[model samples]
Target: INSSIRSTYFVSKLRRISQIFYIELTPNKNLIMSVNGIYAEDSEGKFIPATQRPDGTWRKPRRVKDGYVPQEEVPLYESKGKQFAARKPQLPVGMSPEVALASRSKKSGPNVHCPIPGLVVLEDKTKKKKKKKDATVEKLANDLTQTKLDNTPPDPAKRLKNLKKKIREIESIEARLLSGELKCPEKDQLDKVARKIEILCEIKEIEKQIYWPIDTKYDFCRRL
Candidate 1:
């Protein structure tokens, strides 16, 4: 029984050692070769066979003596897109030279300009139209300016009186608002009137300080 147990233990140890050795020797499953043979990546993370020098001259299969590598011989880019191709010109047989020339030549239109220099010169195509002001709008603007001038008081006392009147009107509206008599009182209008009142009061104070009682040269001369 002791011999059997020892043999079984040796076998398990050998299996584990074998597994470790195999893992060390085997390549990683993730390191796979490219499907297409266009190019392969190396351990350095560079494409192999490596890209050719940029200074290399382009060549065609027609020549063999010039020592130029044929363009077809060079490997194509890995991510190369669709090949370029040009469309062939369509022409009708038995057509006159002048008719063919005319067909090729672009027709002169509103946008198209003549390519023949010193033969046909294109003038400025943009035509600006003059816009006339509406008489009604002009009259309204004039009336607005006249109304502003007429409403504005020239004297500080008159201006202050006007401001005070506007303030009283605003206060009455505010009182109505507080009493819920008026649903929506113009807060902005009230604020404007209040600001005007403050400004007028300041202007009146400044005028009072600026005007002082002093005997002038004219007054002295009149007394003499």
Candidate 2:
């Protein structure tokens, strides 16, 4: 009987604690009413300034000055003190800086052995003479070609045949152009064809007339 009474008492206490917790968790109506009344008190909304800043506008943006070192100043180097000095090139013994520079300027030939003092370099004149003789022979051969051309007579029959062939080819080209076989005809080619046609006509006239025609001879015409 005592255990049953104790259990009932514990359950009743838990119920009372739960009731108090529910009341505390529930929102207060009075606080919500006060907040709504504060908002409605003023008809117009709270005025916001045109700009957030007190100066009315922001100051000019700062200019970038990073990596803008002066030209007079030397840039930072990885090496420091003695290590940096050691990195510089050192000249050999008995060699002055000016002498070293002069030696570098003078390029040694492929045939040169040692650049020691008092080195005798004898030039082979026999090879130079042979080369000069060969060049003279070549020049003589070129001169002989002009003489041969002047002495040689051109074959009239071969020239006439070539001229006739050119005339035929020009005619065929014109025919192809008229038939629309050639899309873009060259002006230079057309002019050449016209010139050849004129030449051919003159040659034909020369062949037809054996002798020059004589006009009436007068004393005044002979003086002019």
| Candidate models: Cα lDDT each | 0.50, 0.53
* Candidate 2 CA-lDDT value: 0.53
Worst 10 residues of 1 by lDDT: 57-66
Tens digits of per-residue lDDT for model 2 on 1-224? 99998997786667557644543454441111222121111122221111113432323312223343334445556657767678866766555787656555554632322354334243466866888899999999999998999999766556566767778878888888899998787997687667764657644544333233444232232232
Which candidate has the top score in lDDT?
2
Q: What's each prediction's TM-score?
A: 0.21, 0.28
Return the lDDT, model 2, position 62.
22
Best by TM-score: 2
Off by over 4 Å in 2: 1-127, 150-154, 173-193, 202-224
Q: lDDT tens digits, residues 1-224, model 1?
A: 99998997786667557644543454431122343423322333323232223443222212123233345556765432233222323344444556545544535533334454223333444431112236667888999999999998577666556756776776777688789897865778657645754655554553453463443222222232
Clashing pairs in 1: none
